[model samples]
Target: MNKQIALHPDLDDDLLDVMEPDNGGSVSDELSRNLRALWSTFYRNRLLIAAIVGVFMLIGLGVTMLMTPKYRATTSIQIDQQSTNVLGNTDQNSVDPAAAWQDADRFLQTQVDVLQSRAMAITVMQDLNLNANDDFIHQMGGKPADRPAGPLSLADTKREQILNVLSDGLRVDLPRNSRVADISFTSPDPRLAARVANAFAADFMIFNMKRKFGSSTYARNFLESQLSDTRSKLEQSERALLDYARSAQLLDVSGGIASSTDGSTTGTPRSLTTSNLVQINDAYAQAQAARVQAQQHWEQAAATPPMQLQEVLTNPAVMQLAQLKAQAQAAYQQDLQRHKPDYPQMQQAAAHIAELDRQLNSLATSIRGSIKEQYATALKQEQALSGQVNGLKSSTQNEQSRSVEYNILKRAVDTNRTMYDSLLQRYAEVSAQAGVAANNISQVDVADTPDKPVSPKPLINLALAMILGMMAAAGFVLLRDKFDDSVRTPEDVNSKLGLTFLNSTPMLDQEMTPDEALSDPRSALSEAYSALRTSIELSHKGGAPRTLAVTSTRQSEGKSTSAFAIARNFAKIGRSVVLIDGDLRKPSLHRLANVPNGRGFSNLLARMGSIDEAIQPTETPNLSLISAGPLPPNPAELLSGARLPELINELAERFDVVVIDAPPVLGLADTVLIGSTTEATLFVVEANGSHHGHAKTAVRRLTGNGITIIGALLTKYDARKIGYGYGYGYNYTYSYSYGQPDAPSSSRKWPWSKK
Candidate 1:
């Protein structure tokens, strides 16, 4: 017998899958298995998916109903290819109309930008009186926010926010390849929307007119200022000229620099008196030039040496005589040094030198007289020029005196006349332009009241809601499936529990008992149990397992029914089977079979009754059952007794198969004690009831007690639901054949095949 040990189901994490996967199985088999597991997950979570989708759809419907509606109004304005300037042509460099036409789209975009500007929006708001409109103010936001401490006052801050609200409703669009632009605004009231859009178009035209005629206003003011300054300057010049003429006791000239009457002047010709004075000035200037030349020559004669003079230096005779004298003197000096001073040669040389010297002195005297005569001649010429200059100056004294004040008055009056004439002309042009009353931009169309609102589209919202709901549903299902630790699929239990899948029993009717299922041998339930019996018989090497114990992680996992069904099926096949209710703590065998629980395992273990009285007959053919006898005070103590194993062996001797329905291994040691005594253990796992941790812990509990597990029985299995295979036919019962010749040829080999 296996050693009796103590362990709890939830106390270990290392007890799972001790047996590693075999290096066997084809890829096709693995694929089919994974697909089946996925199908099972979807099937189980279908309701959750539906609930999520329905809830989301309702929410979408609610939002669509409660949402506010708005009306949009658009006004069209024509953009001409070339803009006309209503202002007068005062600007020197105006834009070429041909170039402006080429960039019409750019200009159109500029208008669009202007339409969308905050400045435009503020104007529209003021025009609509939106600040004082209760509906408008309430719709934007009832009260202004507490003003931040900054440069702006509270009213200014509020105005900024109102401008933003207005801008949000404004939109401007330029139609593709067209010369027209649209100005649109949205509002809760259809009439209001139309009114606001029309107002914007009208205001844009007004603003454009102001822009075009702006130069006219500037020109009028500029001309007025210039006219005033000129009038003052003209008066000042006239007054000054008159004051000077009176102070000098002189006659008034016929004309000034410019002729004027009534102190008003224009740029015109001068009078005869002025012309005569000009002629006199010309003569005086000529005379002064002549006198300056004579003076310059006189000074040169007096200050310079006669030899340096042009007249003296240019004399050829003087230059040649001087050269000969120098040579003769040199010759005399050389002879005197060679011989006595009384020698004839020396006397001749001296006599030649004396003659040359006397000739040089005569020439020098002549050059001096020539210089003096030239000086007197230059002095007389300069005085004559000076006397003419003084005579001209004296003769024009009256005219010259009048001319000084006259020129000053004339220049001032001429400048004032020119400036006044030009300014007056500009003022006239500006006034004419200002009266033209035309602007380049003109409104082409006005907005009409809209009949339909542009928001709260119910159908679209519902469709989007449906799509979102389905996505949310799928996400939640996958999330739950991923985090779930329970074993819901056959592959999950087989892979994680490290156990052989003997057979899967379809879920039987809740109203029917296991003994009742045994009545119909050809039923799906019977066939499933039959397959399970065959698996247990072939699992052992020598022969069929004589004693098989069935148990699960916790209570109500259908272990008792599954074990009884297997035993009942065995008995139906002509094998003598005895079912023992080994779960003394919470036994359901007596109730399931409608048999009395008096004098069963607890009575027998306490030695209160004989084994013959403990055993009872069930309605199942060739099948006998023993109830849990009575609720024992301590089931673990009674199961651990040395007589328990001997009694199990005695039952095995009497029957070909002994099926023991052991207590759950989660919180008690009853299953472990029973499993150690049995020939083989069948871990009964409910389809969705057993968790990975619980099953693993239970398996470890039995294995730790040295009990060998024969295989796992997946009870209450739903075939059609999991999509593995349906019907009690070839696929569900025999889907293990994936072209492997040595395969078990049935679903039994799918989870437990070694090679």
Candidate 2:
């Protein structure tokens, strides 16, 4: 006994579920597939990839050719503090070596600035005599050979240019916590670079020392002149004071007053004897009398009323009163001259005179009070002066003792002057010794002469050129790719229409009729047809498909040609194949099959002819063609009739394989009608001709009409020009044959007998 197991229809679904988790499976598969797709696309465009790489290589090469080489040299300097005698013994306690090093660093930094300054650049240029050198001028690119030189302008320009060069070529780095600095420079000429660097260091040191020495010397000279003037002035003041004391007999007055007043003097051998005391008293008394008399005279004069004549003349109130009196007197005189005293004018003048007299009395009282106060102050001052004079005469002899101390101070000033002169001489000698130029900087390493130019932007130029070239090529490729809507791969055919790829028919350079294509079946076109046959036969796993219809989305997409090719291929494989022209509006199978273009599907449908009479044999055995027969006024109506389905069913039973060449799916109902009755619909897409959207619309329209869409076949595909290389059909060449030979003749069929 035999046993059978039936699997559920959902088995495939369960297997897929087990193979992949829901979200993870979908995402991972999608990403992997997309990446694979992109990789395939890149590989397919190998020529474009090669071109891009070549462009980049050329760019690199061009850049290398245009680049220049640069050379560098470096020198180092150590800042050291040198002791000098001119620093003075006073500075010995204050000198700090660390602080001195700091100061030296700051000094060197300032010297760096000075070295790059315009003044120093001009000095260096003049010393080198660079102005007349042809080589230097030529290097500078003298636009005007005879340009006039303005010292200030030329100096500024040269300084700026040299500073720029130094900034670009030179690098100075100071080590942390160290007094040493590293200086480096890059240039075209190694020797010149080293020379300039060393010279800069030397000049900086020399300039700093000279500036210090000159400033010190100038300060010393100024101080000397000031000291001399002070000494001279002091001497003159001393002499004048001494002479005054001697003429007044004020010398020894301090001790003389003590001796005369006390009668017993200590620390002095001379005593004020009675006679000398009488003499001193007499002098003092006489001076006192003379001072009293002078004071009394001054007081008496000051007590006298001060001259009030000018006050009376210039005082506003006094002047007003006087002017009124004068005017009244003039009026009185004028009235007396003109008339009697009793006249009206004379009487008015008399009244004015009385008013003027009252004002004058008030003015005189104020002026007298001012003068009295001044006289009282003068009298008080006179008394004080008399007392001061007596005291001064008494102390005159005591002031003479200061003469000894003045002489001592004069001797000390002379001694200090001699010492200062000697120190100044020593300072000069030490400064001269320090003036000798010493190396502030030393070269750590010498740079060998460079044999190559540093820069001409070769690499940069080449890179830019290559980048631009690639950009331009990509732009062209993108532009061309954008406008093209052709199918180029099996994925294009399958994914564009949500259909399985039945086969891909590569194009042939040479032309062959349908009959010849079947006989010589080793061609690429024949091989593609065979692939199509295989894909069609394997579409439905259950059983063989009977009627297959080939159609397109638009006219002239080679649906009829593909149908004829497929029918010939099937016939060659010992199958009875019939080619039917289902495109009633525009029949093409008759032309492709080289038969009469009349009495095809339309004639049979309209009952004008029988199906057998309509069917015509082609040059190839077992392959037949059905022409469109006659033009139908309403192709859609005829195709939709019940007779069409009955006719397709009958043909399926009669022929092993029936290939229908239907009209384009869009803009016509004939393809839909034919598709409804067909066992399978094969969508024929022309490579690089039919839009992807159009192919999708055709599949959608056929499937919507309950037609079983078997798969897709790409027709007229140019494998070589699709971008990468040829398709699989032409990858290798081999030979094969199909179909069974006719039965042997009756005479030969009887036993295996030789004639």
* Clash totals for all candidate models: 3, 17
lDDT top scorer: 1
Q: For model 1, how does the per-residue alpha-carbon lDDT over 284-320 read when each residue is reduced to its tens digit?
A: 5665566566567656766776556665556788678
TM-score result, candidate 1: 0.56
Model 2: per-residue Cα lDDT over 240-343, one tens digit each: 54564455444433422224356643332132233355465665566556556656654554565433445555778787778778988877887787788787
Q: Which ten residues in a row have the lowest lDDT in candidate 2?
A: 1-10
The CA lDDT at 52 in model 1 is 89
Native-vs-model 2 lDDT? Answer: 0.62
Clashing pairs in 1: 257-410, 258-410, 600-629
Worst 10 residues of 1 by lDDT: 1-10
Q: Judged by TM-score, which candidate is best?
A: 1
